[model samples]
Target: MMVDDRAGRPATSSGSEGHVLSTPTLLGDRYQLGEVIGSGGMADVYLAKDQLLGREVAVKVLRDPEPDPTDRARFMSEARTLAGLNHPHLVTLLDAGTSADRPFLVMELVRGTNLGEATRRGGPVPPQRMAEVGAQVAEALAYVHEAGVVHRDVKPGNVLLREDRRVLLADFGIARLVNDTAHHTRVGTTIGSPAYFSPEQVQGLTVTPASDVYSLGLVLLEALTGERAYGGTPTEAAMARLNRNPEIPSTLPAGWVTLLQAMTDPEPTRRPDAQHVLERLRALAGGDDAAATQLANATQVAGATQMMTSVPPAAARPEPTTSVPRAEEPAQKRKRPYWAIAVGIVLVAAVIVALVLLGDRGATVPDVPDDVPSQLRDPLQDLHDSVEEAGQ
Candidate 1:
């Protein structure tokens, strides 16, 4: 359950439509609203019971009822960004809709403490634990980047650590899709938390996956030092990194110092991708790359166990001496989910449609700030409409 910012009162706030979705309130005829677990500037997060799934979920409802169209569109973009992602270390978006013109996102409720609260209560984490947490986040970001998403905010508060000490990066409210033009990301208006902002972000520059790496670097630094690496107001903190680097202790765990510095480097091009960071952490933690190793083995097995290829039937079909798909004995017991393949094909088609839209929009540039991209001109009106349609 999320902690209510207003400790004493019920987690009730008037929505743009002038209604409060308090406890016992039923949303979409499925989610039984419970305690107000968390609150933020834009939305109030409620712990709700999913009657359909028979599980707990966190419902984040937008606070602004009378938001301008731009705000509404940005909300939809955030939702679509979350919807496109599917990864273990990222909070999954299960459902989304609107209640009385107020959009809400139904997400998997993550238990255990957020990294900010955990670090505050426990101080710096154990070295091995830190590396493990970092690895999980990096791996997740790698996946997110591969999907053409940039998590603009990568901070401790946005990271949740489960009981197993595994970490999940959450809160992509300000995340920008690859073809997204930052209409909201105007000059003189920075998007991310200042303490964790990259140097280019401070200057209002175009961001890439490496920008997330720089921010994650600060988060891990705070985890290790038990102190914030930057100081002053958000604006001041944003500007501080312009002339200086994060002060790191000369002494760090074997490979961490090098990794940390590279991540926080002022130059965006200098930072390593999330995958490399994950690989380095795995090396330092002395853990085998189970996922990579399995992929390699699966590739070899699949190639050798092809049922019918250019070769003759007897040569193509390996003798079924063993149950697993291997060269010598290729008795295949597992079959891939055809439905999953169909879904993949459908999603690819949808993306191709979206790409055409992106291309069409690229022809007509928006009158946005120099910092914003020319190709990202369209207001996410279509995405915003989809949210309402989903809810209905």
Candidate 2:
């Protein structure tokens, strides 16, 4: 479930549309809405019971009755994006629809607290536990990035810690497909939480999966240190990342220092991809040489597999298998028009007559090449015989 400090209170300030439920409310004819479990800037999450399936689920309803068109589109886009993704680390989307113009999403109710709240109350997480959480979130990122979606908003509040100790990455409302050009927010407006914004995101540049990697790096660093990588107001925090790299503590293991430094690099491309981050975190969590060896072997196998299936170098791209057919294709399609052959025969006969009349009788007529089509060649031969007889 999305843990919030504002539980049991209304999500909206003045509107009756998003007022807290003092009584049991039935939404979409199948969900029995109870107390609001989580509240955010855009939506309020309720602990609901799925009457149809007889299971406990969390429903997120938009906070405004008359939402901006862009917000509504983003709400629906989250539903669509989550519906297609199925992964262990990702929160599953069960159902979605609008009730009286207020959109809602039904997801599996994760009985747990978010990483932000957990860390705030419990202080810094141990290094091994932090690595575990980072690994899980990184694995989730790897999955979503492969599916062409960039989780533009990746932070501690969005990372849920289940009671069973499994971590889930949730709240994909601001997420967008990497190839999707239609943005929910207007141009020049940044979307994610300011403190967690990647450098490219702070500058309002085109964001990619690398931006998510950067944000996750910040998240992991905070999990380890119990402090944000940047401070001050939203604008100051967002701009600070662009000016310099996050401060990774010297007390962290050398492996962690290296990973955090690489992840929070000022240059987006300098950061490691999510899959690599996942492997590194997992190895770190293992805390032994055996795990390091396993990671090395896995990486070697992955490299060899990638090389085997990768596009061949330019030298081998022009396939020899198709070259023979390519060379013969033009000859196979070579065809001459019959009318041209006839015109040529007439022109040749006229030339011969002109030469004879001019007293150059030794000059001979030229014959057609052997490659002419039989359909025209046979007719030309008959025409040639007729011309010879007429001349005689």
Candidate 3:
């Protein structure tokens, strides 16, 4: 039998291996640590199960050399910030407490891969998919912004893609509560990914929603192009963000170009708000304008062809006789003209009916004149007659 140090399962210890930290029988006797998920400068994240709730969660424990009074306060404040935010796209903070002299945050366990891993494994995502991801993240940011929180780090690694392909924004580690103590980010201390950091963040200024939008644009760019919009190295990345323009990929959807441009605008004020981004995404996804037009044209052509094939030939009418009794001849002659006119009118009506039926089959009909030419205006005239008959 072998023991897994991370899972805290009992196992045979090998003398050759270094001693592992004894798994504490109790993490405040509440959360049962499972496996290490990830570690960052401030904390180590673990897959944990909450014994009380019998539910899986992510536990992020502060690193050793516990945070100073000020840091601890800030950490607690972050927990409060997460507690206040109620959004589907954000990771929900379930609980927070001090355990073994370390502050830990129990968060909703988000299954599936992060954007970074997905991008690395599969090339750039499709433009439509990228738009979807961006829109979702933007909505999350919008919610946090409304709560007066600024997520200082909005990079690909913090964005997770779930099994159902929903985008979830995670790891709000460096996020700051706007109403809290005034703490300006130190200059030259790069907080977010250089490739995705906005110019304002690079300048060590207080980050805003616009900064998040700028970072999201970079993520979108990478997702669409399958490569960083800036450069390879950190230094190059920073410089690119500061001085270079993002190269628009030819494969990107035309409607989305404006959206990307607005997102990556150097001037924060010029950028579109999250609400606007959401609207645009909805429009694209629901197949508005361009898509609808294309579909209408396609259906119209098919309808016209189908109508021509299904219509029955006009029924033959008996021809009026020329000869009759002398006395009745005059009456018959008079009736002949009337019968001829009625037959002509019936033939015209039949053509109109055929055209209207064809038009009703999804073909767009042109406007009809009051005295339309018999040969050139059947389709439009037929539509008018059908409408008039329906009203009657």
Clashes of each: 2, 1, 2
Candidate 3 segments exceeding 4 Å error: 1-25, 68-71, 184-188, 289-392
lDDT at position 352, candidate 3: 55
The candidates, ranked best first by lDDT, are 2, 1, 3
Candidate 2, TM-score vs. the true structure?
0.71
Over the stretch 1-392, how does candidate 3's per-residue lDDT look in tens digits?
01223334321122322222368434768988765566665566767778998977777776565566655665676688788888999988888888767788888776677777677768888666776777788789878876767787888778887767777888776787655565534444555678888876765555566677778878877877778888778866875554445776645665565556556766555455565566566655664635523432332232211111222333343322221112332343243343354455566666556655554444333345334435546765656556556534
Candidate 3 residue 164 C-alpha distance from true site, Å:
2.3
Select the stronger candidate by lDDT from 2 and 3: 2
lDDT of candidate 2 over 1-392, digit per residue (tens)? 45333342332222233444878878899999987777776777887889988988889888888988888988999999999899999999999988888989999887667788778878999988888889999999999988888899999988988778899999898888877878788666667889899877886667778788889988998988999989899988987664456777779876677667666755555456788878888988888535644453344234311111121322222212111212232334434433444466667556645644665434454565555546557766665455445555
Model 1 scores a C-alpha lDDT of 0.67
Question: Which prediction has more favorable TM-score, 2 or 3?
Answer: 2
Reference-based lDDT, residue 232, model 2: 97
Higher-scoring candidate on TM-score, 1 or 3: 1
